[model samples]
Target: MPDPIRDADPTIAAAVESERERQESTLGMIASENHVSEAVLTAQGTALTNKYAEGYPGARYYGGCEHVDEVERTAIERAKSLWGADHVNVQPHSGTQANMGVYFAALEPGETILSLDLTHGGHLSHGHHVNFSGQLYEVEQYEVDPKTGYIDYDALAERARAVDPAMIVSGSSAYPREFDWERIGEIADAVDAFHLADIAHITGLVAAGVHSSPAEHADFVTGSTHKTIRSGRGGIIMCDEAYADDVDSAVFPGSQGGPLMHNVAGKAVGFGEALEPAFEEYASRTVENASALAAVLRDRGLSLVSGGTDKHLVLVDLRESHPDLTGDDAEAALSDVGIVLNKNTVPGETRSPFVTSGIRIGTSALTTRGFGPEEIETVAHHIADVLDAPDDDATLERVSESVDDLCESFPVYG
Candidate 1:
């Protein structure tokens, strides 16, 4: 290990050590998070953060930007190469900001827009009344089929045609199926609206060729570097040449001022890492683990939305098998035994979004930690035990032991 940074900044260094201990001890089952390499962490703590390169590479508002320009340019090139995008803007700060930049470039305030319903797996920026997208624009929502628990393209098209929105946002925060990017683009074209695909959760899948790439079909695409990509917390926007200037302007002067060079450097490392041969196998294993986990739940007589998952996440319907348990209770119960997941709404859920009827599980964190299909199934069985008998001391104890044993086999950051 390198020398402890504690010698320089004891305050932050202590916090870092505490976080490291937390990670070493806990099981991370969150769908939206992943562990990054030490190299990525080092890039984030570099001296690049001290500079004020408030503008793009050469066209900076300050001096001493020769080296920082290379960092930003390398990030931009790697992004473009990864997705084959004509234009790449690597300064949005987050996936939400990437979505916002696209929206700001394409739509004016008060314009009608088509987006997915929040409770049905859509992101907050897609049109939640509390989000800026909703506060500034008129939103028309579309929902999935009540029984199928999958995206209803026919209904989405109907709503898009009815609303005649200026833009159509396609993506989700908790959706577990592959997106029909071409169908979404067709709908956007039929309604004469701009289409943006928010592939934040599936960016790694796209990069690794495990899922459909929206960059090839949509007018614009946005993604995050932290999720399945196993990078830092950052956002990126990819667009065609026709919209390059507008998109770049929207990201820079129109939205944020200076880009986070350290984060961008980390993004470059992640992009470089993704291009390696091993990343494809890692991503494929992630999907396989998700499917394997889902199979265990179904075999145990638990209902899974859409029957099962096609990617790295599964939505288990608590209303069916565990009728007495609410999503909130199940989440807390599972957490008690060291398992983690977010409570989410199913298509036909009668409960509110806050107190949802389902829990969303992903295998990204576990897959990155080196768990394969067999291990994933074992963990899934343990999760079922924890959920079915949260109050049983023996059951919780057994499940906790299983979790510890599994993490022990695949120790993180050791």
Candidate 2:
């Protein structure tokens, strides 16, 4: 088969070829990644890339942007329409940069922020000491309820009251349940702080109405255009009209130079797809598959963090199921059989993140590839079956064969 990427960029054709081969050969189960439509891929390589529009449409720093003006405007309007935001900035290169714009627009360099702990599902941009957001700001951490393995709304508010943060952040990377966004909003109000919702992982689901929309309760909502949105790689910050100017400026001269017009075009296409009714079905089914897999795992007496999943990902605690197997080992075992998944830290992880006691499995990709509850169940059983007897190359081979069978039934990237 002829790969379009080959003809498009022969300079990087080898890299593209290798990446496509990897995708075709294995399951991409990472919650944060998704397979965008070929239409999206095409849009991302449009002729709009030749322009250098450093400013907003109609207010550019350079000329020859007449066509790009419509592109930028379309992207802005579609993103705003999809999310119901008073203002939208689809210029950030990625989620982290989108977060940077929010921080720049809303805070002084040394202000304080109270957010969920990174290990507890919070993004690094929320304030891990290693990230720029943490280095420039004071960060207070919150945790999930130990017993429930989910955010403790009450505890969060208590911490907000004590820290008196300049901002309160809500969202998680590995969290399996819906968050109390309204409660977080109330906490921000009580503390007279701005509320920023990092819905990067759930943006698609939220846009499709399968998950709660933070735009209603948050002052600033940041998300990636990919994930559930299944767009290209980029970030968006949606907010009220009150901060639009600051937000736009922060993204342009403040954080990035020229907006990647190709990425913006892809975002526009993705936003359009999200506005479709079928997108809702995709989002819902993604969650359903996650839940189904969690059930099968739990039914086999394996303890799942938070008991089960309410979203498209599950954090399976391995302490009981694979007594001696670290998350790293299980991840390798699954990979050996083409059942790709990432090892992640559970709350109060028993070991380091690199060798944790849990695996984080997400169903957005598999579901998008057309796997439903039945296939998810098959995947769950095969994972448990193989990991139960790790080092059994025979079981790994069998699982790999089954994976290929399911994948063949629903062709990916065809």
Candidate 3:
């Protein structure tokens, strides 16, 4: 079949084809990315994109919204079932915006927000000084125990007492360990603060029961639909019914206008797919592959933060094993060989954020492409080979060829 986009606009059509080819050819190891299914892709490209449903289902500001209302209702119901939440709002454009919605609903401007430090695997929306959360609210940060690469709950409790923040944010972008959500919630309660668990990177894992959920522990939970969940590209907020109206209004008239109805349809489709038993198997395999990759990297004498991972990503700190190799250089070398990951700042990062001391690699995309433990171990060796001698032309060419062969063996789309 011919592509309609090619007939309508050749330039954008070429870029889209190139991107699809790129994903098929390369290994996507970025911890925050994954490939959505064809059903989800089709849903996002539907005529629902032309609608403007400015309010909730059955109560929209527009008149011709009956079909979109059904889609939005399905998305909300599936999200609630998937995460066991009492209320869900699937309107925020991104995970960061989801956090904004919570902040707007719960805290007044200039109130304090205590969260994990960015260099220690926290996100920008979790009170990084440059973000709106940091600008509008006074931000206090906590860090992992540098010696053990784990969060110190005792220290966090103490800091919460001192800061007396309005909200406490839990979850991370690159941290390889699971959070003690109940304990964090207890601390938040003790401090009289709302707990916001930003599980942007582990939504599918949580839904699949491969990771502990914060839904029961935190006051609010937020996640990106596109990461491990492989849903549409948007954000979702989950809360108890007590705060449903506040959250809904904050997401609608307070921060954003009409919701992206096409993305909501995609979310509905993807969430429906996730409710199947196969998604649990996929989520379990993703974690297992990540563990295998971690073991191989450690055997190769590479140092992993926290000594290992319980999720889909491993954070490799090069300060000890490869002190001279910066994360930027390692990322470039890996990219040259068709492995796509990102540079990341470690717990005690000394270098700048752009050229950090560590790299974060994930197995979600490869796992989606059907890579198992054996394949993941092989890829781990390739990573070590390139990082061991990043400048060797002969090694680069050999690894590039090997990567091409592997990508051919495990095609993303067929």
Candidate 4:
């Protein structure tokens, strides 16, 4: 039988097929990406996509939303169970939107927000000048300790006290170490500021108890459902029950209109999967694989942020070890060899963000592909080799072939 997509639009079908092949053939090392389970993929493609459940589950604006209401409710309840939050909102379109909702619910425009500096492993949504968070609110940034490549909590608290921000964001995109959520919460409390912990990059780890959770420490917790969680795509927001109405209204009327029901369905399936014992094993191994990768890179003389990782990713600073090599060049070299990651600005960065001095590698997708510590060690060696001799054709060829073999051996899809 002819494929339905191909029959309707050959161009899109071709691109989709190519993308699938690409994902199957290469290593997805992006710290923010993961391969969702088949059940999630199927759920996201269901008839729920046709619904417009503009409001929360039992109180939708639309009439024909009974089924979608169930889906969204299931997603919310499952997320609450996974994170142990007092209230959960599974309707945010993305992590940024989730943040926006929180901000709208809790702060006024022109209010101050203190968060980690972007060049120091922070996310754009955390208050970068280019994002709404910065343009709308007064933003003050803190940085990591230059010598240790870890958040300088002392400095952060000092700055927070000085700025007296309305909200203090505690989470990172490129930080390899776990955050001191309790300490950050205390800092926020000292200033009578709300704490928004954006755990977009480590949602799965926190859910599986592999990393420290901020749900208990922060006033609000936000995360991407797709990252380590392996939910197809979407974001989640959690807050205490006291703030539930404000958060829900902010999400529905303040930030976005109707929720993306299909993605909500995907979140439901993924959250259900995470509740399983096997998902706990997967999350644990993801961190273990990351540690294995870090060990190999350090052994090869690569300078890692924080000197190692306590989560699913490693941030490699190239400035000290390979002063001449830019992160863009290394990223391109690794991509050529079928290892897909991203160029990231490291702590104490001297170069532009586009041409950074560091690269971020992750093991969530590799772990999802069934690659263990031994496999991760091998992949890490290949990465180091490629970075060491990026211009050598022989080296690139050898690493590319090995990457292909590894991808085949550990297929992303069964």
For all predicted structures, in order, the TM-scores are 0.97, 0.96, 0.99, 0.99
- Residue 380 C-alpha lDDT in model 2: 90
lDDT of 1 by residue, 1-414 (tens): 665677888999889889886666667878898888888888888998988888788899999999999988988898887788898988889999998899988889999878888777789999899999899999988887768878889989988888899999888888888889999999999989999999999989888889989987799999889999887679999999999888888888998988888898888888888888999999999999999999999998889888888888998888879888888888898887878787888777789778888898999999988989998888899888888788999999888888878767788887
How does model 4 score by TM-score?
0.99
Weakest 10 consecutive residues, lDDT, candidate 3?
126-135
Over 4 Å off, model 3: none
- RMSD of candidate 1 to the truth, in angstroms, is 1.5
Q: Please provide, for model 3 over 1-414, each residue's C-alpha lDDT reduced to its tens digit, 9 standing for 90 to 100.
A: 988999999999999999999999999999999999999999999999999999999898999999999999999999998999999999999999999999999999999999999999999999887899888999999999999999999999999999999999999999999999999999999999999999999999999999999988999999999999999999999999999999999999999999999999989999999999999999999999999999999999999999999999999999999999999999999999999999999988999999999999999999999999999999999999999999999999998998999999999877
Which ranges of candidate 1 are over 4 A from the true structure? 1-12
lDDT of each: 0.87, 0.88, 0.96, 0.93
Error of 1 at 334 (Å): 1.5
Ranking by lDDT: 3, 4, 2, 1
Model 2 ranges off by over 4 Å: 1-11
The predicted structure with the larger TM-score, 1 or 4, is 4
- Candidate 1: worst-modelled 10 consecutive residues by lDDT: 20-29
